[model samples]
Target: MPTRWELDKASIYSTKAGEKDRTYLDSAFCLTDDVSTPSRHEGRQVAIGKKVLQTLLTQLAGQGSALSRERTALVVATSWSDESYFVTGVSGKTDAPAGFTPGEQVAELAAAFALGGPALSVDTACSSFPYALDMAQALVNSGQADNAIVMALNTVLPPALFLGFS
Candidate 1:
């Protein structure tokens, strides 16, 4: 029989105040809000999508997601990778003043939550979430981690990108 990996916890963050009860029945969600927390690493801004994921992850951790954080793998999926640049624009900073390593969202999240297992970001356009899920399952199945957190975020899209996708 195949080992079952049950979902212990799930959290969601949206424009509306649906974070407390992050569920499919959230009654029409939107991502156009300026919902973002300040970055810890300078010169590196956190995109809206990352911000949303961070909030959800924080909620999970706060409510005790039953994760052995250090043994948990994190995989984030999204098509907007370079959104930090657009959000940051031209900040006359010397280095990554805020957000770590520049363009490395996984690194920042891992550091924030202290996830010591394999963590990575996946960008395969529209299907990135599934790809990330596969990678997460592979990590857990391969014994690299005890469990995994798969986050898919696509929000605060710029006008041009929104048009293209539309």
Candidate 2:
């Protein structure tokens, strides 16, 4: 028999000005600077993803410091994966900068949240979120973790892609 899984809490941060909450999904037409940082390795997508993860984790951990515990897992899904889109296109660099891969982003989040469980990043374009959620569900159902944090991030930081499409 499969075990039952439940979502205790959720958070979302988008490029849109009014779509910070999931309830206002329709307000994500125009992209905005929801998560902008000056860090070299961190881009808009990573920043937003980190914010969402932190919010959800903080809610789950409460005031007792559940984040320090190792009973939770993190699964992130994104199309561009990391800051490669910006690094390669805008900077015209031939190599990816440090902490630009999907796996590295996961590691950074794990370290920041002090998560000790398994961390994975999935990239399947438009279907990445669903795939990540499925993976997280399996982890919980298999008794690998008591809770799982699933995140989906997408951003068009570099103007090349947007300009090209336009």
Candidate 3:
């Protein structure tokens, strides 16, 4: 299946050096809620999630041909929060703590395009976005959708989450 949501362009926005002790700011919007602080995951988590959705929407909108009124596009986003406690589990019952409510964020993004389709969030271990991309292609191949948006976002950090990757 061919990708309907072509990654024609992408960008990463980082905070000024040492702003947060050199921690990865990952997204333009940073999540202020404490991911591991038990009850402080809403603010930061939502901020990061919205920032991601906003970025994707912005990119898609930039694609004059991709944005159309007659074609619907599906959006799928993945995050590593499912494996990190820093985000906690209050955001939603996903495999991740900072995971955004699928319908809420997805719809928020889809609504931006005049021809948006169903929006979904998937937490497939480390391959969430790849799986979602496959699904999106399937949608387009099977005549279910004309376009798709798939993104993988992980901005927060948990010590154990990346113990061996360095």
Candidate 4:
């Protein structure tokens, strides 16, 4: 089985400089109106997608989704390593800024909700989100865990990635 949410190409928290300069290329985002700052790492990280996951988590928990409680484990399907640069884009494929890491941040987010399942960071670039979902579903289907949270988060418009677009 498969489930997914692909955000349409639109501007939710985009900076005018990017759009106007033709340098900003961001994917559709799921964000809270309250959090309205255009993130420098809009496509690779700190994009509106995180807000989308949080919202979905809340809704699922409210509806009693299998992965709502503390017993549920979450496997984060990510592309860039926390050690990768937020401003530098995805790490494995390229070099990012110094001291930028995601492992600690991922753990912190999971801990904030008191999650008990195995917390992991997967770096599959572009495919991170769907992969994460698949991993979560597999865990549930295999009965290894009651529920799973797979988070796919990435930002865009990095200097290196621009070549692909051009």
Candidate 5:
């Protein structure tokens, strides 16, 4: 028989709130920063995404077995990965500051938590979060990792995309 995998811990951040729990559907809401903010090195989405990851780590730390540079996997799902640079044409400029790519964000978080597992970034439009979760679950189930961190972030709206839709 296949071993049953259970969701050990999870965290969420949004325009409305942030949450963390062991069960999948916990309804408790915690006050969090507004999801929209000015475009900068530490933009709104990146800030919130970091907060969500930190919250999850804090939760795990409370349990006395914090994932410290362990072989833990990281999976991030985002519709836009540092699109601000592209929208503002900063990416084309020679003096563009280092923007937070989705993969880079994951790497930073993993490094902060001392996680050494595989890292993945997924962009599947509206279903990005679900896909990230699936990937994390697969990593854990396949014995590739004992723990996995899955994060989904959607930050600033691209003016071009907005104009196209409008």
Candidate 6:
């Protein structure tokens, strides 16, 4: 049987930097990545989520810590009804008629990471992040995984969001 990890809600927000856990105070928004790098995904296909997921994995990877590919889980919090218009002008984009569910989206992103842990996606509107945290916590607590990486993201901001700011 796998080890039952005692996880904290803020575990992903902090990292082990020496003897103590360092809490991150820096906040980032409106980030963009130049997709010039090769993807680690199997088949090395230049997919939509591969590059972004790789960029986000930097902090957890290469640390040589207890968290292994098999022990860590992945949870993505996004609206099920997120932007569907970005299908055009982008590669690896899937439209609504296709497998356009949040679960499938996260599953693809999870595949890019090549991790063997449990992976899932949650859509709870504004409460998504919190809901995702709960689901991630449950995954660890239930011995499904040792740890989890929670990403609250959207494919693209819908027009309604911009209109609200206007």
TM-scores of all predicted structures: 0.61, 0.63, 0.50, 0.55, 0.64, 0.59
lDDT for every model?
0.60, 0.64, 0.52, 0.54, 0.64, 0.58
The alpha-carbon deviation from the true structure for residue 82 of candidate 5, after best TM-score superposition, in angstroms, is 1.9
Q: Candidate 6 residues 75-96, lDDT tens each?
A: 8887633233233223353432
For candidate 2, give the lDDT of residue 162.
Answer: 34
RMSD per candidate (Å) reads 13.6, 12.8, 12.5, 10.2, 13.9, 15.3
Angstrom error of the Cα, residue 129, model 6: value is: 0.4
- Residue 98's lDDT within candidate 6 is 31
lDDT of 2: 0.64
Candidate 6 residue-wise lDDT at 33 = 37
Comparison by TM-score, 2 against 3, better one: 2
Question: In model 2, which regions exceed 4 Å deviation?
Answer: 1-36, 39-42, 61-68, 84-99, 157-166
Best-fitting candidate, scored by TM-score:
5
Q: Tens digits of per-residue lDDT for model 3 on 18-134?
A: 332223344456445444433324434335555665666678678854354356656555554422334456446665444345455455456654545656777676778778888
Off by over 4 Å in 1: 1-28, 31-65, 87-103
Tens-place lDDT per residue, model 5, 89-127, is 443556555666777767766776677898888988789
In candidate 2, what are the lDDT values of residues 1-166, reduced to their tens digit?
0111112223322344443332222434644453354333435456767777778767766866565448788888877756643454444344535446788778777777777778899889779999999999999899888878888766543333333333
**What lDDT is obtained when candidate 6 is compared to the true structure?**
0.58
Q: Where is model 5 more than 4 Å wrong at Cα?
A: 1-44, 63-65, 87-96
CA lDDT, candidate 4, residue 84: 31
Q: lDDT for model 5, on a 0 to 1 scale?
A: 0.64
What order do you get sorting by lDDT, best first?
5, 2, 1, 6, 4, 3
Cα-based lDDT at residue 130, candidate 1: 90
Name the weakest run of 10 consecutive residues (lDDT summed) in model 5. Answer: 1-10
Per-residue CA lDDT of model 4 for 15-104, tens digit only, reads 444443233445555433355643333332433445655687788878886364556776766666532344344333343334335675
